[model samples]
Target: MSRGYNGTEYFRNAPGLLSVRLKTRLMWDGRLDGADLPTAVRDMVTEAHFMNADGRLIQERIRQIPELLALWREAFGAQSQPYGPQIFVAIAEFLKTLDGGDTWWTAPCAATR
Candidate 1:
């Protein structure tokens, strides 16, 4: 349901973030290293067919958000800035918490009883 800013539809459907921690490879083509989540996030953000965002611009805009800045300072250190890499790392950390463990999808089928 999403398209790039340039109006191009992605060739492959975006996969769900669920259980990403258990994946050994990411993306439909498995081009990215799943063990390196930060890199995957950076690629998605910078890719022309994806976010198409400039890292410098993203950091500059983030610097203006007081709440986000406060969070960055608290998370990284009092002197930390909202640099692009840290942004990707933070996003990757958040994505790691999206695991679907114990959800109904993991439960045995009741009809099998």
Candidate 2:
């Protein structure tokens, strides 16, 4: 006989709750694909991933946390003293000035274009 509504089944567990205790961790050996940002910056990004991560960083399964690019944008965007907004305005104007609206330029450094 089954105690049908006793709710003692593992299969009836709450969604996303089962994986909640399974922490995801991240580990990196510090490799950089681009020459512009420097090793330190790249390493900082990787370290941030681990530092901001939970104990399960080795599993590398965190939610949508910001990546390096997003981090840069957010960090820069939040700055005051007119530098960030000034540069932002200049870039917006510059992008508007583009003829083709696209360029095959290396990011974080436009000189490579």
Candidate 3:
């Protein structure tokens, strides 16, 4: 069932990640309730056609970075450091900052006035 990277309509605009938080479901089929960003990030990383990476593997790799480990500790106060779920949380938080610049498409048009 893996779609395998086709480089065709595979990626969405990064800024759209912010808007997805308002969605009731995640993924194209809209099966995931609440569209939870952490859950979506975890699924994307582990899904075969996407990152295809094990959560444990990602955690191990991230732990090797001293700066990131420190930031994780400061952010979450985790004594053990770099908990697997923290990675997803961090990614979700970062995506929240991707609010796209205000453009005509995002502005209120005269029709609404």
Every model's Cα RMSD, please?
Answer: 2.3, 21.4, 4.5
**What is candidate 2's lDDT per residue for 1-113, written digit by digit as tens?**
21112333322222221222122321132243322222222232334332232223422321134463354456456432223233334433443343432346525677766
Q: lDDT, candidate 2, residue 41?
A: 25
- Local error of candidate 2 at residue 24 (angstroms): 40
| Candidates 2 and 3 compared by lDDT, better number | 3
Please give, for residues 18-92, the per-residue lDDT of candidate 1 as tens digits.
Answer: 889889988778887888899999888898899889778789888898987888888899988789988988999
Q: What lDDT score is found at residue 36 in candidate 1?
A: 88
TM-score for predicted model 2 compared with the true structure: 0.18
Which of 1 and 3 is ahead in TM-score? Answer: 1
Poorest stretch of ten by lDDT in candidate 1: 104-113
Ranking by TM-score: 1, 3, 2
Best by TM-score: 1
Question: In model 3, what is the error at residue 66, expressed in angstroms?
Answer: 1.3
Candidate lDDT (C-alpha), each: 0.84, 0.32, 0.71
**Model 1, residue 31: what's the lDDT?**
81
Taking all chains together, each candidate's TM-score versus the true structure is: 0.85, 0.18, 0.69
Q: Looking at model 3, which ten-residue stretch has the lowest summed lDDT?
A: 7-16
Better of 1 and 3 by lDDT: 1
* Residue-level lDDT tens digits of model 3 in 1-113: 33444443444432246555557777777767754788888887887656778779988887888887887788878786676787898888776667765566666786754
